[model samples]
Target: MKIVLASASQFRKRALDMLGVPYEICPSRIDEKAIRDNDPASLTRKLAEEKARKVASEHLDAVVVSGDAVVSKAGRIYEKPRNLAEAAQFLRELSGGEFQFVTALAVMHSQTRRMLSTVEVSDISFRPLAEGEIQSYIEKYSVLNYAGAFESDAVLFFADRICGSYNFVTALPVSRLIVFLRAQGIKI
Candidate 1:
């Protein structure tokens, strides 16, 4: 079966590449900001499902994979930052605190109309960050492009601890994806 990824995220693409699976990119052009839910997990899953469904409609013969992520802390769900200032704010708020980094994945087989979905939650603790460190991180990497305004790999120095699948925290949750795909008769 043909495989397609319904996202434009470089992190997700890199995760898929690590799986050694051949796939095509068909970015789902959905207005992500329009989708909202009070629960972070539910919101991420909804977004993932929507993205997969949208791409599946256009590629009826392909199995489309899509995912979404959010950082939840103190009852607030943080998605990608809008700008550098927002990124800095997010980092500052998260400094020296533990937060849940939740990610959801959806895989749809358009022909069979079968779908598999799962959510992975990871706890991440950040060391107390100074204003200068936050600013330096923002200037060094594309922090505004990532949920929570930080990337695990890029912010290793600032991350005090991470408990869960590092891959999931990074965004793709490939281990879970592999299991789900295998159950659907897809060899990766």
Candidate 2:
């Protein structure tokens, strides 16, 4: 089966590539910021499902994999940082604190009326960061593209502890994806 990755996230693409899966990239164009009044966990699943369905509507011969994440501290949801100021704020809120990275994945095949959704949770503890360090990293990485305003692989924002799959926190759960694909007979 032809595979379609319904997102533009480089990290997720890399994960699929590492497994030698040949897929097409078709980033969904839903206005995610417009979603409100839903819980973080629910939102993650809904967005993934929405993206998968949107792409599935256009392609009948492929299985589309889509995912979304929400970084939650207490109960507030942290999306991709809009600017340096918001990025800094996200860093501060997560400083020396443990938060949950909730990622949801959706696999859809329009031909079979088959759709699957999964949520993987990763606990991340941020190291205590200095103001200067935050600013420096923000300047270097340009936080417009990263969710929660940080990257685990980047030196400036390292997680002291992680309790779940690292790839899930990065926004794609590979093992789960494989399982989902197999369930649909879509060999990855």
Candidate 3:
């Protein structure tokens, strides 16, 4: 079957590429800010499904894969930071603490109009970061493009511990995606 990725995120694309699948990029241009919920998992699932459905509508012959991620700490949900200042603040608040990185992946078979979705949650622990460190990191990388303002691999030096799939923390959970694809009779 034809494969289409319903997102523009390089991180998600890279994760999918690991499966050696030939897919086309068709970004689902949806207003993400309009979709929100008190529960992070539900919010991410909704966003992922919406993105997949949006792309699937255009490509009825392809299977559309889309995903969304959010960070939750102390009952507050965080999406990609709106600006550098917010990114810095997110890092500061997450310093020396634990947070949940929740990622939702959705695959829609347009012809069948069937979708399989899953949410992966990872617990991340951070070492205490000074204000200067946070500022330096932000200036050096494009944190505003990633949820939680920090990439898992990029922030490994300051991340004390991770309690789940590292790929999920990066935004796309590849293992889960593989399972979903296999269930749909797609060979990875």
Ordered from best to worst lDDT, the candidate numbers read: 3, 1, 2
For model 2, the superposed segments whose C-alpha errors exceed 4 Å read 155-157
- Compute each candidate's TM-score over C-alphas: 0.95, 0.93, 0.96
lDDT by residue (tens digit), candidate 2, 163-183: 876654347888888899888
For candidate 1, the TM-score is 0.95
What is the per-residue lDDT of model 3 for residues 1-188, given as tens digits with 9 covering 90 to 100?
88899988888888878889998999999999898899999999999999999999999898899999988999999999999999999999999999999999999888888899989888988999989989899999899988889886545768788897675544788988888877766788
Worst 10 residues of 3 by lDDT: 164-173
lDDT of 1 by residue, 21-92 (tens): 999999999999899999999999999999999999999888899999999999999899999999999999
**Candidates in descending TM-score order:** 3, 1, 2
How many steric clashes does model 1 contain?
0
RMSD of each: 1.2, 1.7, 1.2
Local distance difference test, each candidate = 0.87, 0.82, 0.88
